[model samples]
Target: MEERTRAYLRGRFGDYYRRTELTPPPGANEREWGFIPWTSGPGTTMVRHRSLLDLGSIEDFLARKRPRHVYFSAGRYDEPSASSMSEKGWRSSDLVFDLDADHLPSVTLGEDSYAEMLAKCKDALLRLLDFLEDDFGFEDLTIVFSGGRGYHVHVRDAGIQGLEREARREVVDYVRGIGLDIDEIQTKEMRGNTPARVIEKDGGWGSRIHQRLTALSDDLKRMDNEEALGRLSEIEGVGDKTAKTILGAVSADQDVEGYTENEEVEINYEAISAGNIELGGVGMRKLIDAIAEETVSAENAPIDEPVTTDTNRLIRLPGSLHGGSGLAVRRIDRSDLADFDPLVDAVPETFVGHEISVEVTDGGTVELRGDSFTVEEGVHSVPEYLGVFLMARGRAEKGQE
Candidate 1:
C-alpha cells in the first residue's frame, strides 16, 4: 500500500474509534491485546503481548493508534502482559470455532462471488450452532462475522472454560464427526445373561440416524407402490426379492412399533427402538449405514480444529475494522444471523454516505452495499465505502486530491 493510502485509512480508523465505544471482552485486564498498525508494506506486523492496561482504555488506545486491525486473546491470564507463554499464568480460555469460507469444501473458488461465499459460510455457521446448541446444550455463545472471509463462534460456558487442549480436541472431533464409528453409538441390552447390541434412539448420532430412517419411511409411504418398490430396489444391496421382503415387513400383519396391517413401513421400528437395527434385514442394514453416512456429512460442522484447541490464540475483536477488507468485525445477535449480509451489514458507517477518488490498480467486478458494478483499470470516483474496500483489498490506490 502507498503511504498516502495508509495515512488516509489510519486517519479514518482513528475517527471511527473516536465515535465508536467498543465493549471489551470479559476479563479484559486478564486477556492480552494486540493490534496491527497501518504500515507501508505488503505484509502486516502484529503488535501483541500487551495487556489492557498497556493500551489504556480500548477507546482511547484505538483512537491513538488507529490500528489496521485489533484482536484479543481467547485465553485469559494472570500476567497478561508477560512476554512469554510460560510466564503468563494461564487460567482459562473460551472454546472458539472458526469457519472460513475459503476452507469450505462446498465453495468453488474463482467461481463463487463474495456474496455466495458468505452465504455458504452462514449455512456452515447454522450447522455449527446445531452442534453447540442442541448437541452440547451450550447457552452462552457469541457469534461474530470475521469481516474478511468467515465466522467465529465463542463458547463461554463456564463448564467448558477450563478444558485442556486434549479435551477441547475431543469437542472438535465430535462437531467434525471425526473418528465416528456407527458401532460406537450402539448400546448393549442384557437379555438374561446374554447382551444384545442396539442402536440408541434417545440422542446423539444414533438418534440422528433414527430420525433420518423415519423420514425415509415417511417418504416411501407417500410414494405409489411401483415408485416405492423401484426406490427400494435402487439400494445397492436390495434385490427385487429383498425389496419385496422389506415391503412385506413394512406391511406386516401386526401393529407393534406402529407398523399396522397393510401399512408400508420401510424400517423395522420395533428393532430400531430396541436399538437392534440389524434385525430389520440385510438390505435395511445397508440402507441404514448409507443414511448414517449422509447424516454425519449433512449434520457435522467443519470448524477449524486448531483454533478451538489453541489456548493462546489472538482473535479479531468484535466491532473492530478488519484492515484487509475495511469492514467491521461485527458481533451478530443469534436471532439476526439468518439475515446478516457481511457485504452490506458489515460495511462501516464511518465510510458511508461519501464519495472518494481512487486509482484502480487491479479492478474487477465489485459488490458491496447491495449493488454490483464493474470497474476497469483507471481512476474513478466512487462511494467512500467501496473505495475503502477496494483500497484495503489492494485493488486500488488513493488518487491525488
Candidate 2:
C-alpha cells in the first residue's frame, strides 16, 4: 500500500494494527481457502489519492464517519477461489445504504474522468430520489459519497425504523428494480458491506420522509381495517415508505424469512464476455469482458469438477439462524494475511446465489450458472464475510455472547 493510501486509511481508521497482507490460519495450508475482500479489482478501483489520512476514533467514525457499511468480504487475489470470506463464514449488520445504477461511474477511455464519475454518481442520486418515491413509497432519499469508489444513499426516516441486512437487500433490490439482476451483485459494492461515506453531504428530504413513515400509524376499526386492508395499494400515500409496513397492514402476509431467502447459485467459471448474456432465472455473477482483461479463453478455465459432475453435496447453511451481522473481527490475524493476496484472478463459470438448493440425486442435470469473477483479487479477502448474516441477528437476539 502507498503512503498516501495508508494515510487515508489511517485518517479513517486511525492506527489499525497494520499488516502487509492477510495470511491463512496456521493449522491449514492457504490454498484450501478462497475469496478476498476490501480492495477493488486487481487493476480497477485503485486508491487514486495519496494524501495520508487519520480517522480520529472508530466510534466517532461509526457514529459520524458518515460511511455506512453494507457488506463484508476477505480473501486472496492470486488464487481466486483458493480463499474467500464466505468460506471463513461470518457476517455483519451494516447500515447498508445502496444507490441506483446511475450513481456508478461511466469511465470513458483515458482522460481526467473523476468529473464524469461524479456526474453519473449525482445523476443516479436524482433517479434514486424518484425510486424511493415510486417503489418505496417515499418522496425523498439522502445521498453521500462513499469516500472511495461508490455512493451511499441513506433512507433513515422513522418509517423503516431500521432493517436487518437481508431485508435491506430485498429493499435495495426492489428499489433497484427488476429485468436487471436486482437481487445479486458480482462484487462487494452491490452488497454494500465495505467502508463507505460521503465526500460531501447534507441531510434533507430522505430524512423527512423517513420520519413521516415512522409516526404515521392508524387505529382502525375492524371494518375500517378490513376496508384499508382491501386498498393496500393506496395506503402507500398515507405515507408508508416500506412494503413491510404496508403489507403488515394488508390481509395477505408471507413469512418474511421464507419470502426473502437468498436465492442460491453455484459459479465454477469466471470472466466471460459481457453483453447479451442471461442466466435463465438468475443474474450473471460478474460479467466482465474477459477478453479485454487477459487471454484466458473459454476452454482455459479450470474444470476440476465437470459442469455435469454429480455428487450429493449437502451444504447446511445456518438456515434457522438467519439475517444478522455475524462478527466484526477485532483484528485480522497476520498468518491469515498470508492467505490474503492482492493479485489472484479467476473466471467464475457460476457464482452462487443466496438460495442453496440440494441436488436431490446424482446424474440429474447439474449445470454451471452465472459468469462471475473479481476483475481483481485481494480486494475482498474474507470471502464469506457476508455468509453468516444470521450470526449478526443471533448476536442481537442472544445479547452479544
Candidate 3:
C-alpha cells in the first residue's frame, strides 16, 4: 500500500474510533490485547503482550494508534501483559469456533462469488449452533462477524472455561463428526425372535439419523412401488434384490386394511427404531452405514479446528474495524443472525454519508452495502465506504480532488 493510502486510512480509522463506542469483551483486563499498526512496507507488525491497564482506556488507545487490525486473546491470564508466554500465568480460555468461507469444503474458490461464499458460511454457522445449543446445551454464546472472511462463536459457559486442550480437541472432534461410528450409538434390543440393533431416538447422532430415516421413508411410501424400488436401488450396496427385500420389509406392516397416512408413518418409524427391516440376503447394517455417512456429510460443521484447540489464540475484536476489508467486526444478536448481511451490515456507518475519489489499481467487481458493480482501472468518485473498502483491500489508492 502507498504511504498516502496508509495515511488516509489511519486518519479515517482514528475518526471512526472517535465516534464509535465499542463494548469491550467480558474480563477485558484479564485478556491480552494486540493490534497491528499502519506501518510502512508490505509486511505489518503486531504490537501485542499488552493488557487493558497498559492501554488506559480502549477508546483513547484506538484513536491514538488507528491500528490496521486489532485482536484479543481467547485465553484469560493472571499477568496478561507479560512479555512472554511463560511469564503470563496460564488461565482458562473461551471455547471459540471460527467458520471461514475460504476453508469451507462446500465453497468452490474462484467460482463462488463473495455473497455465495458467505451464504454457505451462514449455513455452517447454523449447523455449529445446533451442536452448541441443542447437543451440548451451552448458553451465554456470543456470535460475531469476523469482518473479513467469516463468523466467530464464543462459548463462555462457565463449565467449559477450565477445560484442557485435549478436552477441547474432543469437543472439536464431536462437532466435526470425527470417528463417528453408527454401531457405537446403537443399542441391542430383542425384536420378536431376533436380537436387533436399534438407534435410540432420545437425542444426539442417533436422533439425527432417525430423523433422516423417517423423512426418507415418508418420501418413499408416497411413491409408486416401482419408483420406490428404483430409488432404493440407487443407494450404494442395495442391488435390485436387496432393494426389493427392503421395500417389502418397509411395506409388510402396511397390510392392515384402511391404514391411515399417520399409521403408515408410525409403522415406518417402528421398523427403523426396532431395526426390524428384514433385508433377505443383505443386512440392515450396510443400509444403516450408508445413511450414517450421508447424515454426517450433510450435518457436520467444517470449522477451523486449530482456532478452537489453541488455548492462546488471538481473535478479532467484535467492534473493531478489520483493516483488510474496512468493515466493522460487529457482534450479532442471535435473533438477528439470519437476516444479517455482512457486506451490508458490517460496513461502517462512520463512512456512509459522503463520497470520495479513488484511483482504482487492481480493479474488479465489488459487492458491498447491498449493491454490486464492476470497476476498471481508473480514477472514480464513489461512496466513501466503497472508497475506504477499495483502499483497505489494496485495489485502489487515494486520489486527489
Instruction: Give the per-residue lDDT digits (tens) of candidate 3, residues 1-401.
Output: 88889999999999999998889989999999999999998898999999999997899999998898999999999999999988899888999999999999899999998789999999999999999999999998999999988999999999999988899999999988889987678776676778866776777888888887777677776776677667767877766666655655555664433333333222353464344434322445566666777888899989999999998989999899999989999899999998999999999999998999999998888899899978889999999999999999889999997
Give one digit per residue, the lDDT tens place, for model 1 in 106-164. Answer: 89999998889989989999989988998899999999999899999999999999999
**C-alpha positional error of residue 148 in candidate 1 after TM-score superposition, expressed in Å:** 1.1
Sort all candidates by lDDT, best to worst: 3, 1, 2
Which candidate has the top score in TM-score? 3
Arrange candidates, best TM-score first.
3, 1, 2
Which residue segments of model 3 deviate by more than 4 Å? 188-195, 237-245, 248-282
Backbone clashes in model 3, listed as residue pairs: 318-329
Better TM-score candidate (1, 2):
1
Question: Who wins the lDDT comparison?
Answer: 3
Which of the two, 2 or 3, has more TM-score?
3
Indicate whether candidate 2 or candidate 3 has the larger lDDT.
Answer: 3
Please report how far candidate 2 places residue 165 from its true position, in Å: 5.0
TM-score of candidate 1 to 2 decimals = 0.87
